[model samples]
Target: MIVLHNVQKKLGMRPVLRHIHMEVKKGECLSIVGPNGAGKTTLLKVCACIHQIDAGSMYWNGQDVYKQLTEYKRNLGWISHHHFLYENFTPVENLRFYSELYGVKNCEETIKRWLKIVDLYVFKDIPVRTFSKGMKQRLSLARALLHEPSILLLDEPFTGLDQDGVQLLFHLLQQEKEKQTAIMMVTHDFSHIEKISNKVIFLHKGEIAAESVQTEEKHIKEMYKTLVDER
Candidate 1:
């Protein structure tokens, strides 16, 4: 459902991403693991169309991304380090607000379902800023999933998540995969790929250095170490 063709990106005069090519099909979860300054985030932003790719092209599903920005974006769910919810608003309130913005039809049911799925039902009435890191992360996941976009792009999704929180969120992602949601995750940790991802994309030196199907070995950590040391 996602394709990149000879994509290149630069920050001022410094190249951050170079001629990257990758694809993820429906129901596939692709994990991206790379070192700091390795262009992992840049690659995600380029795919998400949050940043303009300097050269080559990107296609979502079949249409060129730049040609149909609104339609293409409507099909994506992006979760990042930044929180889009209002801190002063309650979890339910924040979700309701977004539901309206997205013009979601079943707003109330969607809100309840996500809160319960994230186990934030009891805290639904509480303001978001008062929440701990883990709670806020859960709420962020809820907000991203409300419209049920076909593709999910998550950057550092496990940040601030406690052990149990991490497990819960992964379980929800598994459900999304079962329902044929395409996913591309940018993460430093490899633990969840065995369960969630169908393929692994490893970025090194601002390019796609390794690509492999998931195996019993979540090999990115070890392989990245060896590759970096050799360089």
Candidate 2:
């Protein structure tokens, strides 16, 4: 589980996140939604430890992340807008490099399995530079899930996906959920992943304007519209 207590962050002189508080338990998915510049992405970065909070604390399974940065990071997987891939490398090569960095033994079989899971097995040896946007996104996802981290931080993962790609993503997410991986996703479109989400927070101006527990999808949608329309 991960928890944030009154977290705050600033970009230069401007405050980006203010008094943010949230929790994500294993097997749970939390969706963050808001208008542009609402700091949704920043919040995810903070949770991923990519951005440090200027104030407050973030904890992983009861331990303060700052105190055990390396260990904490080992349990995290993050995906943002950028593919973060080596364009010149093939899908297999990319995964191989990551697997090596992660010190994952017997990665040969694991890499193959993930490539097949993402439906990119046939193109595993092709350079990423030649793959389409949706294909690149799929490969990125495969990289993220390579280590089977305990927590996932995602930012707009569905942006460039086609119908089949979306289904593949959903399928992988479901598998991760079953494996008890905690997930926090930032998205404007929640229809695809809503069923798997256990919580939704409507953020506004770096604060949570509205929140809903699982099973309150209707309430979440209503509040999302109200919040976005009001802004």
Candidate 3:
């Protein structure tokens, strides 16, 4: 399980995450929704350890994440607006690079399997620069899964995807959830959130305006609009 207690963060003296608190259990999904500048991405970045918190505490199971930073990071798989792939490298090459960096055993086999899972195997040998945005997104997903991390921090994971890509992502995430990987995602698409998320949070101006457990997508959107309008 991952837990946050009174988390706070700032970007250049402007508070981005304000006294935030949340928890995600193994095999659970948490979806965060908010209007622009609500710090949804910043929140994910904090969880991913891309940005250090200014205050509060985060824990993995019973261990302090800041104290056990290296071990803590090994359990995280993060995807944001940036794909973080070398455009000049082929899909297979890209996966190989990350696998080696993560010290993954069976690197080749794992890379091949994820490529097939993401429907990128046919184009695995081609450079990422030659791939479409949707294809690059698929490759990015493949890279994130290669290490089988216990936690996923995703931001707008459905961006630039075709129908097939979207469905594939859903299927992959479902598999991850079944394996007890805790997932935290930021997305405007409530339909997918309703399908996969057990918890939903609405944030406004870096604060959680409302939260619900197992809410319907329609209600979630309704709550989101209401919160945004109140701001």
Write candidate 3's Cα lDDT for 162-187 as tens digits: 99988888998999999999999999
User: How good is model 3 by TM-score?
Assistant: 0.97
> Model 2, which residues run further than 4 Å from truth?
214-218, 229-231
Cα RMSD to the true fold for all candidates: 1.4, 1.4, 1.0
Of candidate 3, the 10-residue stretch with the lowest lDDT total is: 72-81
Give me the candidate number with maximum lDDT: 3
lDDT of 2 by residue, 56-83 (tens): 9899989999999988788788877799
Question: Which stretches in model 1 have alpha-carbon errors above 4 Å?
Answer: none
**Higher-TM-score candidate among 1 and 2?**
2
Give the residue spans of candidate 3 off by over 4 A.
none
Give each model's whole-structure lDDT.
Answer: 0.86, 0.88, 0.91
Better of 2 and 3 by lDDT: 3
Cα deviation of 22 in candidate 1 (Å)?
0.6
| Alpha-carbon TM-score of each model against the true structure | 0.95, 0.96, 0.97
